[model samples]
Target: MKPVYITRTCQIANDQLVMDGVEAVLDYKEIIADPALRRRMSRIVKMGVACGLKCIEGLTPESIDAIITATGFGCLADTEKFIESIVANSERLLNPTPFIQSTFNTIGGQIALLRGIHSYNVTYAHRGLSFESALIDAAMQVNEGKKNVLLGAIDEITASSADIQRRLGMTREYELGEGANFFVLNATASGNKSAAVLDIDTRSGRLTDDKLIEWIVETANRNGIEISDLCIVANCNTATTDNIKKRLSLKNKPLQFKTCDYPTLSARALDFAINNSTANKTLIISDYQHINHSLILLGRG
Candidate 1:
């Protein structure tokens, strides 16, 4: 299949989650130009829409063929608030605003409405692989002859969600954070300025070191490159990194972005790789629960 190009990108990460070498969190504007609608939507919705608008800057909204979003915990802040109201008011006469905006697909729906775009819109909620799933769908759409696709990942941490994450052992070494990262993808480069996504692969369940190494080798060979020619970027701790490197006998250390929460981990790693001009060929690896992994290969064509 022909590679899809990333024409534009807009990333909004939690301030503390951003890597030291990368740009800081995006300064998102609270108001969305429409006063009436601005008063109804939640922060997450506005944030996602802002990133979406930025991604499609200088382009017509009608040019977009689809809008896909992935969120681990969607509208968590509003969810918590709505739950609190339900508990306080005996689940009667509660404000519908919170409940309406708390859906996992709200971001995609809101973007579609705001832009008057009536195209294919979808959302994915596949835990750690949510963003990867959305990316996969967008790529598939492009492969199927769709011209332009808009996709993103939005996840936020609330007091309720934070406590749950702690109990689930998801915040052991990484700090809880939030983000809304958006991108515009096309079948070909818009004006010879886009980055090509060579391939993407995601795995679930148990995986051995040999199998992991083999997958990397096969993917690199398919792209006409060697392991040494690609820079590995992963969201992993020192121990995990050491295990992978020692097992694969890798000399080039992978760029680690393990300090943030799940939703922004892989997105931030990709942001770093794209922004770093010195990196020629980049490979992104997201290791979830030390078992399931998602790998992506990107380069300039």
Candidate 2:
């Protein structure tokens, strides 16, 4: 299999969006401050466009083949507001814009419209695997001869949703935050610095410790790799780390980062692995509950 090249990448956090000391393409606070739903939707569309534009170095808008997005909680603030309005006013005279924007595919549609990309646009919202699904889709498209693709993920941590997840024990103890991460991918290799996604696998059931080790070994073997070739292994939780160590007999030492942040902040691990220098490859293992949700292999081209 050929490696898909990453043209550029950008990230926006709740606190601020900065790239090498420059302000981000969109300001989160400014967008949230808008009271009107229509205006807020417009702001989101603009932000998506700005992110796409910023990620594509010198390329123009016409260069993009498609726009794809993955958002775990799509327009959560709008959803919460709509629900609150229904409750406060006894479900009478409810606005429609919030309801419209609350759909999971709204960001993708808005991005397509802004970029005039009539090509294969899609949005995936599969919990923790949301962004990974989008990445896989983008890579497949690139491998199928598409020139350039814009892939992104965005999730908002609204107050009410945070409270609900807290009660359900699905969120972290700290305050919920919002962020966006975007990337541009192409088929042609470039001299620019980028991470190559080798393989992505997803499973639905709980994996036994031995089964998890077997899965990793098989995946690596298929790609002509050995256990010692991996420089790092990133897992979703400490339990996952221990499971890999015990089952795989890996003693290279793993780095685990767990804080009172977003529960799905495992995506941050991907970001960390990509930025850091490693010997050969980095294996990213993400498990949800007892289910082995996703495994991604990443390396340089």
lDDT of 1 by residue, 82-116 (tens): 98999999989999989899999988998888778
Which of the numbered candidates is closest to the native, going by highest lDDT? Answer: 1
Off by over 4 Å in 1: 15-31, 191-193, 208-210, 247-252
lDDT of model 1 at position 171? 78
Task: Evaluate all candidate structures by whole-model CA lDDT and list the values in order.
Answer: 0.75, 0.66
Error of 2 at 85 (Å): 2.1
Model 1 vs. true fold: TM: 0.89
Error of 2 at 283 (Å): 1.3
Could you tell me how far off, in angstroms, the CA of residue 202 lies in candidate 2 after the best superposition?
Answer: 0.6
> Candidate 2 has which clashing residue pairs, if any?
none
